[model samples]
Target: MQVEYQAPLQRLNTFGIAARARCLVRVRSEDDVRALLRQPGWDWQHTFILGGGSNIVLAGDVQRTVLKVEIPGRRLLREDERGWLVEAGAGERWHDFVVWTLQQGWPGLENLALIPGTVGAAPVQNIGAYGVELQDRFHSLDAIDLETGETFTLHHEHCAFGYRDSVFKHDRPGARGMGLRGRALITRVRFWLPRRWRPELSYQDLQRKVAETGIQQPSPWQVLEWVCAIRRAKLPDPAVLGNAGSFFKNPTVTAEQCADIIGRDPRVVHYPMPDGSVKLAAGWLIDACGWRGKTVGRAGVYEKQALVLVNRGGPQDPCSGGEVMTLARLIQTSVYERFGIRLEPEPVCVG
Candidate 1:
């Protein structure tokens, strides 16, 4: 375990906002996490877990101990006639894990290529792209209870995963559920991947790319490359420019509500949600509001993708000077004005 006080979090988070943490600890092992949790004088209310920090935004200084989970390892635990059970540490970089699986000829994660964040955070959000979700291949995960310092194994059912949500998101505290709000910290994740290839080309971009390339069935590597290309084109690279891939999740509304919104704006793009609802494209809504490439202070919507909010360099005040929150509010207000649907932010905000 590595510990530091008054740590600068600007370099830690992908958003490039410079916020100071009261204290920070990097746990490289499950034991480290257990020991840290067992320590006295650590306020449970003022503690939080962080992974790659790719899906978070720092609103101001964090008056808490930011636990950076860095435990790292990967192993093939079991294989059967159906598929292989691959286990990875929660702290492993998501893209690296996908590359490792692809290099091993494992199928299932190719569609999730180039997604930013850690493996631990994947299950929390049921991260999905190119028509594949983490829950589809998730086997189980190990997490530690913050209060008791006890470790528990959670299966798919226990996770209670939904579209961009899980037990970690909606479950009530102390309510017979794996509530994500400051209750448990994910340590390791297991994925069940198939040996045989079953390529998914349902996403419009994937379908268009395959058709344009004239490939009947592309290999997993080819699929990964194409997805990477698409993501690179659509989402701003956090390394080059500070920004989360997508600030807001696509809004899912009832069929009747969808019809009403489309009637108001015919150009609205809609996807069929799994639960008989309609998922409206947030980018389309934002672009329709003429928010693309619009700048406010140092924050602005990305030129190519309206879903992304970029922190254009300007004044140095990390908390107030940046325009991210302003732009996000603008998007939310405009979308709400144009359509009745509310846009929920995907990134966790810390202060």
Candidate 2:
């Protein structure tokens, strides 16, 4: 374990936001995490757990002890005639895990290729792309209770996942049903992947890509490559620039509401949800509101992707202090005014 006081968080988050944590600790194992949690001097109220920092925005300075999880390991825990169950530590990079599965000829997670985040956070958000979601493969996870310093296993049902949300995101007040409001810290996750090949080509983008490529049944590697290519072209690279991909979640509304919006604007595109709801493209709504490529002070929406908010320049670079909440408020207000649907931010915000 490594501990530091008044540590800079600019390099820790994908946005490169300039912020400072009063105390920061890096834990490499479950035992290290439990030891820190058991310390009486450590302020549990002012402690926060962080993974890859890919889906967060640091507003200003955080006066908390930000625990950066670094536990690293992967293993095949179990296997059956149908699939294999694999376990990964919380600190593992999500993309690396996907690549590892692909190399092993496992066939699930190909559509989620190139997503930027840690494995631990995947279950929290039920991270999805193309036509698949983390929940489809998630088996269980191990989390440590911040208040008790005790670990417990959370099964798929206990997670109560709902479209980019789970027990880890909303278990606390104001978490919007994303279970991990502020109480639990994930340490490991388990996923089950099929032993045989089973491809999903439901998302319009993926289907279009397949049609354009003239491949009726694309291999897992080919599908992953296509998804990666599309993401690379659409979303800005956070390493080169500063950004957390897709600042907002696509708003899901009733089919009636979707019809109303479409009647008002024929160009509105919507995807049918499982429960008789329609998922609207938040990017489309923002673009219709003329927010695409729009800039306010140093914060601006990415020109190529309306859903992404970029720092333009590095944090503390003058061109880097755009208030994410302000931009998000604008988007929410505009979408609500135009379509009566509120846009919710997907990234975790800290101050």
Candidate 3:
């Protein structure tokens, strides 16, 4: 509960943006959070909940008191006839947790390996990779109500999980509103790992690995290894090149719209969703608009993956969040002008 004034945040964010929090508090436990909430004249609305800082862009120094979550723990809460229930503190690194589960013979999370950020941030974005989303394995979560200073729990339905979205990403005024965006702080997350597990290779990248290796029946650990390798080759390492992984969500279009786009451009990359909608590769769209390997100010699109935007200036002269947003806006405008589809940024921007 120690409050540090004017805390340096350059190293805190994966983007390596030079910024500082006006006031910062590192919450290592639920007691720390409760103590902060009980402070005299404290205002939760004037606070910002920061996790690993992986899915955020800081335009400038944050004015709000930043609550840096660092709660850490991992355990198998229950091993029932149904499945194994595992829980992790909000602050635990997501990739590390995934690997830990596999090491413990819990294989449900293998497909989501190598994603940046912490367990708490997973539900906020409904993070998905290699054909498995967080909600697919989520059991429940414990969180604190920022306004009430009380703790509560939310199951998958209460979370309102969607593709890269959840109630935590929204803001609603009334208590009954579905959105919980700025009103709650997650402290712990639990996952239900099935007793029987199967490898998910629906994602094209994993399929390619199967083809190259000629291994039809891959184990969960094997799938994890393949996912890590594919991500390493495609995505730029944040430690080397500052980036927020995929910069945009794959836009879903109607079958008719897909046909129209294909008729115009024969090589458009797309896949059919189970719901019958067509999911277009946002990277393909950006490349079609000629944005790959392009730069704007100190921000640039990654040469390896068009979906990722990187800070070309490096740590010494890192790109500001404004530069990233500017480039994002330019890409969005061009994609919309050419393809009649708007590109939505994935990261939350703050200043």
Q: What is the C-alpha lDDT of each candidate?
A: 0.85, 0.85, 0.93
Question: After superposing candidate 2, which stretches have Cα over 4 Å from the reference?
Answer: 172-180, 315-322
TM-score of each: 0.96, 0.95, 0.98
The per-prediction tally of clashing pairs is 1, 11, 0
lDDT of 2 by residue, 34-80 (tens): 78976878656687788898888887778888989888988889888
Q: Where is model 1 more than 4 Å wrong at Cα?
A: 314-322
How do all the candidates rank in terms of TM-score, highest first?
A: 3, 1, 2
**Top lDDT model:** 3
Model 3 regions more than 4 Å off = none
Name the best candidate (by TM-score): 3
What is the C-alpha lDDT profile of model 1 across 242-337, one tens digit per residue?
A: 887888999888999989987887778999877799898998999998999998877788999999888787326442323577778878998898
Output the worst ten-in-a-row residue range by lDDT, candidate 1: 314-323
In angstroms, give how far residue 168 of model 2 lies from its true place: 0.9
Evaluated at residue 89, the lDDT of candidate 1 is 94
Question: 6 in model 3: Cα distance from truth in Å?
Answer: 0.8
Model 2: lowest-lDDT 10 consecutive positions: 313-322
Between 1 and 2, whose TM-score is larger? 1
Please report the TM-score between candidate 2 and the true structure: 0.95
- RMSD to true structure for each model, in Å: 1.7, 2.3, 0.9
